[model samples]
Target chain A: MTALAERPYGGSRGGPQGGSQGGSQGGRRSRGALALMLPALVPVLVFSVGPLLYGILLAFTDARSGRNTETSFVGLENFAELLSDGDFWESFRIGLVWGLSVTVLQFLASLGLALLLNQDLRLRGVARVLAVVPWAMPPVVIGLMWRLVYHPDAGLLNGLFGTRVDWLHDFSLALPAVIVVGVWTGMPQTTVVLLAGLQNVPKELYEAVSVDGAGAWRRFWNVTLPQLRPVIVAITSLDFVWNINQFSLVYVLTQGGPGGRTRLPMLFAYEEAFRYGFFGYAATLGVAITIVVLAVLGLYLWRQAREAD
Target chain B: MTRALKHLALLGYVVFLAFPLLWLLSTALKTPQEMAALDPTWIPRRPTLANFADAFGEQDLLGAALRSLVVAVATALITVTLALPAAYALARHRSAAGRIAIGWVLVSQVFPVVLVIIPLFMVLRRLELVNTLAGLTVVHVTFVMPFALWMLRGYVRAVPRELEEAAAVDGAGRLRALAAVVAPLLAPGVVATLLFGFISSWNEFLFALVILKDPEVETLPLTLVRFVGPEGVARLGPLAAASLLATVPSLVFFAIIQRRLRSGLMAGAVKG
Candidate 1:
């Protein structure tokens, strides 16, 4: 679908429209298109690109403890500070673990669920809708809900097991607890994508695989997995970006608590900028996150290109 | 034998997904004494809607829900309004710039809301739009526009350009053709886009949390968060009830649009 849209058909069709209506009508159409695009584009540019550029600028300066206007250039000092800051490095490692674990677990869970739902099973529609509940819930709500579920005293876990475990309070358990919520929140969208991919795989191939005495696993590997590669790449790349940026769940659940053990770089950045008033340092972290996201995207696109070839 | 195993695995997966939700519903109905029992059980000992009553009375959840609905509906309307024409142009106009515009839409989704939140905070504060539904709506529209455009663009492109061109040749203006002819065929797409945009805005938390500081303007999610007091102590029964209430609109929306979602998926073949 996307490929066809990108294909260039020549300028000959332009002649009919061009001759019938000279510059004025064409100008009007272009104007109309611009008008339609401006409302959407302005907010995106102002909020997204504007901040990104500002953040990048802040990373190179010694902007601390004031509005952005008070900043002066300190040329890579923030990045240099980040390089030596063990806390920053530690948070980076935590972010890496959070991103990779959540992304991998989410992909697997969703893929498994998608494969299951793709089968000729009863009540598959119900399963699909039910699965999307987590995704539909706000992240803050999911975080709070899970926090309740994971609470030490009266949580569902404690109630079910009759043993108290501090899921979010324990340093070791905190990250995983947050990651579980992340996985739950992300699984639905991934499942939807994978289900779409699975549907695209022609049924005849599966039938053929079965007739050839290929088992379920064999059929999946040979037919389904190959067919789902593009979607897998897309979903995984998206998961990486989403997981890297995840803040609400962690914030609401732990606030990077138990001595910053659960602190992902995003939480670290927030605490630095807002709480600690280290705007330049936070901007540096934001730049680092952006770099990692772009790198992951670059890698995914390259893999997608190779897969296409 | 393998088929049995596969079915079993699926059943297990279903249980995993459904159990937490069931627990939430049960907890919402349980009496406080039953809920606080040392040996807790899944089924409520004395099932009642008292918890729900308490939740509403205690939390002002009904008001928050109305605010959420207003924001979600406004965001959906504004996002679709802005995205439709651009999506239409990208669909019908075969140009290099149009292709780039489509790709750019995908790229826009990659930037994290957290990165934008700080600057947006500053921006909104500057405009004196903070803590207002209007402010949150602007943020939601910006957040949802990319996905809406991407989703609708594919569906719009699927509607044969010849149909709109035929209408144009019949002396219909582009806007008239789009409204009278092209739109009816693209109803499924429009619904799907609206559902996606609506849900995205409806579920969004970060922007709402940062922008809406006024308690009166709180969205459902933000209000739900108020259930948690300092040090992570939460009022479970009320929280569960509010959670269930918060989910009602989305579930209703999903039920109404599920058929359109399916057809849109099949037609566009875009996973979105």
Candidate 2:
């Protein structure tokens, strides 16, 4: 991922020696660069970096939402509370289930669609357009539309199945129902990314495999899988992070509803902050969730990179 | 047999992807009686535009839409203004600081808004900017800045340095060279970035949810969510119609960007 940005461009206009040898010129150039950067950097520092640091500190405090509330340091106390918080553990478990299942399902579904789109097939343009149209959709609209689909009485899901199942409200089905929406909403990008990766694979490898008497499945396993691994790793890790951090889609779909069945980690943190107004605790929740997700992601990416090497 | 199965699989995907959308369009057009029927028809027996009319007539729908438009336009303008020069710097100057900036852009995407937002809310409250569209616009700018920078930098890189150097050799100053030599070349990228920023801000929900507490300031997505409250089937048609309407800007965005998107240049821009 970093490599994309680091792909060396053409001549550096101001070389390293240009500064020291042409001292005044270098100083002026440096000042100009800083000036160019400051417009974007200042807002990022104030609104993003500063708040992010303050939020980390807030995780160690007792900062509530009210104006008159006394704020005090409560180092690791919230963490202690979090450890014993049964509701939180339940929500975290639900979050893992939601994140893992959605990521996996989205990957598989998108891979299938991407592979199909990469084929020499008729109506390819129309299919490609249809596949990507969802990428353009607002998540809120996607959520609301799916809610219509899963509506107990008036929903298309019930109408098609000829069975009355309150998909989003059912204790057993709500998670799966929301997972389907998550997959649908996420498919276009995953498919597009994977399709791009697929298109990049050398056709000669497929020819070599075929000449060696490899069947289609064997060719895919040996040739396609190995070649696509980097893109797979990048996109899937991103998908996992995006899935766990997903709030708006699930929020609009079920509002963590029918007993918080659809509450991903981000949704859980949102509730802590907004619904209940426990600002510090919410920050703690957010921090804890990020550490865990990053650790998992780091391990996964490390193994993949090592394997690639 | 395999070809038939391939066609079948392709058809299945197309149906899976398109069905919900078609269903949404169907719901928007169905009459109340059709929506209330025991069995829902794929095509409405009695189609009507009344639902679309009702969607507009709904309380605050039009106002909320206007608010959404305002925020989106402001975000697009501000995001491009900030991202353009920053992108130019990152593209031209391969400094350690530039590398760090790129690293920060990637890292920023990983951090949860929940983490930043709590402290941000307090900061905004102190600034007396909470519950204001201006505050919401600022947040959207930061939210989109990373990806917009990434995209615009790519576009900047796509414009070869020779052109800028040629302009420079002709006695154009740095800013002059950029404006005269680079800006026109970067117009499509600028428009793409603007559309992306606009769509993201227009569709943003969670930040707006936190920032805009007053119903009077609620954006379109917030207002649309309100329509889905436990009011039952009475509100379904309008909700569907409104949902369909909310998708228009993004559809137009996609139509324009579809070719560039297929080039895979903007792959990293979307969250998922």
Candidate 3:
């Protein structure tokens, strides 16, 4: 979802904040500009906006098919029902744990890996492209591949650890297993972003710190961390949002199984919508996800707006 | 860390990243005899291509791939074609409406695909597009258009304004100037963006699963997932084999555009 391409946290490059005032400023062709934009905007309006609003509207209606299969409006009934659903709350809790673990872990791994790649090591370029291999993989392929690794019998984890645990099936092990896979696949862009941030960090600052007899940790904490802070915060926050929204990987690996232990909110929403045909309930779940995502990203967007001003 | 230690750490990371892919490759080559063994082996004792053959035999990988290719290419082309004008306007012209459009694109990026997928599925069903490649392509266009528009806007912003102005000064219309002067310079960006569009379409799962129900019309991802038995056990060998094949196009396109992607990624960092 442009998550990979746009994973570079923050540097004010005219993203959603509209920092590009460099375009055509003439009054005569404002109409021309509008005309030019019409084609692209039309599809977004037709496909994206229309459905999003419809989905929200569906949330407030009796849109289920099982017992009460009417499309009549029932204001906040789905949401109120959702508030009391233990399964929804359980999914949300799992989602929070899942999202936080992946985001925090991915950030640390990406930062460390980025630092390693930023070093003047030979084959760093090769490593750079190879690092992208995981990111380039289809999420489904990743899920399938990881499922084998987590296989109960003759799995690689078993071979490596001398244990017979069914990683994706064991209730205690399922979420962690899935989290590790999530971190693995989500590593590339964050690493790239941090690596870029590292490379762009002026060399003179490093030399200056080194000349002052600073150790590596001191230098990093004093120089690198501060320099990378905005990027770290930005990427980490976006990663959190992405992790919360992730569906395919977890769906593929466990299908939110092992007694719903790994049923993230997305999978829950999906099951509610497709599996049970609870459109209204599922739409409420969708709205909940959107609100969570917006809340997560709202901070960054607000900052971007302030910066744009 | 010392240079040796740093390289050691880096090597560790490379192993971490490469291990799963290596395992997938090795698993695809392992014979059923090797797979059935109680113990796992690092290298397959009797590496065979039979799993891939079996995978191909089971599902029409070639047909599904063809469908995927048609859909991905169409999505990329249509998205880029539509986004080009929008990107040009967004990049070269800063009006209030244009700004709002950019903002909308940003919002669309984070808008849950699930919310839209249901209704889009309904709309496509009504239009008899539920199982067609064309229908799948249109759905993907909506998914990718915002990203393409924003990314290409960044690229279009990088193209110097003077080139278009120079052509316009010589009696060329604005559109002609854009075509003659700006389009050539945008080649690398277009390639990279199109590659991303292709990858997103090819890798997409939920929309395809929801919309395309016919086996004959299923994409590679759908076919691959169908390998799961009703008992819910995935056929690991054949699944890995087919997965490797499905991933080849994206990996190839990735390599083709790696140089641009590195640059584009750095330049394209707008998704917060």
Candidates, DockQ: 0.36, 0.52, 0.48
lDDT of each residue in A205-295, candidate 3, tens digit only:
9999999999999999999987776677667776887799899999888899899999999899888887888878888888888887777
Top-TM-score candidate index = 2
TM-score of each: 0.88, 0.94, 0.92
CA RMSD of each candidate after superposition: 4.0, 3.0, 4.3
Q: Please list the residue runs of candidate 2 whose C-alpha ends up more than 4 Å from where it truly belongs after superposition.
A: A1-28, B230-234, B261-272
lDDT of 2 by residue, A1-309 (tens): 221333344344554434457678667777878777776466557656787889899999989999889999999999999999987898989988988899999999999988888888775777888888878888889999998899888889888889989898888899999999989988887888888788879999999889999888998899999988878888888888888899999988888888988778888898888889899899999898888789889998889879888
- lDDT: worst 10-residue window of model 1 chain A: A3-12
Model 1, B154-254: lDDT tens digits are 67766776788799889998789989898898887788778777877787787887789878899988888788866566668888888887777677777
Give the alpha carbon lDDT tens digit for every residue of B162-258 in model 2.
7887998899987799899898988887888898889899989999999998889999999988887654334889999999888998899878976
The reply for model 3, stretches above 4 Å from the true place, is A1-25, A65-70, A297-309, B268-272
The Cα local distance difference test for each model comes to 0.75, 0.84, 0.80
Q: Residue-pair clashes per candidate, as listed?
A: 0, 0, 4
Pairs of residues at least 3 apart in sequence or in different chains that clash in candidate 3? A23-B92, A23-B93, A24-B92, A24-B93
> Which is better, 1 or 2, measured by TM-score?
2
**Candidate 3 TM-score to native:** 0.92
Sort by TM-score, top down from the best: 2, 3, 1
* Model 3 docking grade: acceptable
Shift of residue B109 alpha carbon in model 1, Å: 2.6
